[model samples]
Target: MSATALATWTVVALLGVMTPGIDTVLVLRHTIVGGGRSGLAAVGGIAAGCLVWAVASLAGLAALLAASTLAYDIVRIAGAVYLVWLGLSAIWKTLPRHRTEGGGVDALDAPGVSARVALRAGFFTNLLNPKVGVFYISLLPQFLPVGPAATAWGIVLVAIHLGVTFLWYPALIALAARARGVLLRGRVRAWMERVTAVVLIGVGVRLATTP
Candidate 1:
């Protein structure tokens, strides 16, 4: 691909990364509660999901989801349910009632789960969403340079997408980490959790309602 084409693809991929959605909310929530490492794990999961879609798109499997309404609906509904469940779980845990002792930096800084578990949370969250597969199927082809090495070109494009994630997700993690002192406060953490829950639920509703 020419420099211009690469630049264009970068701009588009960055925009997609910066879009605030369930993934962002999840990362932000985890970052606030479990610090930067947890958030980064989620980003890894999101990246892994994108890569999986990239492979599927290359294999022509993603096109099947676009053509088969039943397959699309099944995946969409599952994603919606998973998103809502995550949102509700966040809301439930952050309720003011669960005021455990030592409600300070130590508790707030602790990982909610193991790193592997956190990673899995991220992997499943993205893997289960068919929109991502469909998105790659549609968007990647537009950026592919006409050549015998089109598959190689496609991988490069996906790498650009992953590059955007690396850039955007870490900055977010750092920002959340910087605000760790304030986020450690119970009330602030509660409100943050509420905001995350709302975002997740809103995304789920939009996903479920959208065609």
Candidate 2:
């Protein structure tokens, strides 16, 4: 990629990374409950997702999905269901008696999610989101040059985007981790869990209802 093109892609990547979204919320929640390790796991998961989207874009897979209604619907529903499942799981964990067991564990004791699980969740979340496919099929290509180098350059651009996202999320996780003390207090922790549950559910609902 040319210097100007690389710079422009960097700026776009940074902007997209900084924007708060479901991934951001999920990472923050993990940070608050499980500290830096969990936060990193979440970031890794999200990066895995981005990589899948990047590859799909390069392979023209996203374009094929975009052109097929049945394919799009299947992926969209799957994404919606996954988000709802996550939200409900969060809510269930926040129930009065269940709250103390999971949320109050030390970061080390919990050790957060397994790397493989996180990566898989991250990959599928982004891969299954039709919106992401559309973005890759439409928006990303607009910035790519034509010819044999297009796919290669697109991969580089996506790497830059993922780098920004990975960098940004850790900062967010650190900030949330610092607040762990306050968040761990009985009522405060409970409230935070409740809030996170609601946010997850809202995102799920929105995804399900969106056209």
Candidate 3:
């Protein structure tokens, strides 16, 4: 690909990475609950998802998936359900629970979720969203140089997207970490989780309803 094409693609991909969405929320929440390590774990999960979509897009698998109405509906429904489940779970965990024993510690402050779980959360969340694959299918083609090596150019573009993500995520982690003092506190954390839950559910509903 020409340098001009690459630079344009890089700018577009970087903008997508910086956009606020479920991915950003997941990173922020994990960081708030489990610190920088947990945040990076989630970032890794998202990167895995991006790489998978990138490969799938280059292989025409993403196009095939997008072309099939039944397949798209199946994946879309699954994604919607998963998002709703995540939102409901977050809200349920926020509700007051009685202690089985006297002097039980308050578990509201730190969510106590493990890094692996956070990693899985990030992976499945993005993997289920066919929108990512659809996006790659549409976006990568525009940057391909006219040649038999179209797939090669696709890979290059995917790499650019991943590179932009890598650059953006650490900054996101740092920002989330810097706000740890106020955001991770008991009542504040609870409220934040509540808001996140609502947003997740809303996004799911919108996805399910949109054509």
Q: Name the best candidate (by TM-score).
A: 3
**TM-score for each of the candidates:** 0.90, 0.88, 0.92
Query: Deviation in angstroms for 140 in model 1?
Result: 0.5
Show where candidate 2 strays beyond 4 Å.
99-120
The per-model lDDT (C-alpha) reads 0.80, 0.74, 0.82
lDDT of 1 by residue, 1-211 (tens): 7899889989999889999876787787777787787889888988998899899998889999999999998888888888888778777776545545566423432334355656776887788798898889998888887777889988888888998999999999899889877876767777777787788788778778886
> What is the alpha-carbon RMSD of candidate 3 to the true structure?
2.2
Put the candidates in TM-score order, highest first.
3, 1, 2
Model 1: lDDT of residue 146: 78
Model with the higher lDDT, candidate 1 or 2: 1
lDDT tens per residue, model 2, 1-211: 5789789878988877788888787787777766677678878878877778778888988888888988888888889888777767666666555533554532222322344445555666776688877877787887888899888888788888888987888888778888888887666765676687788778777877886
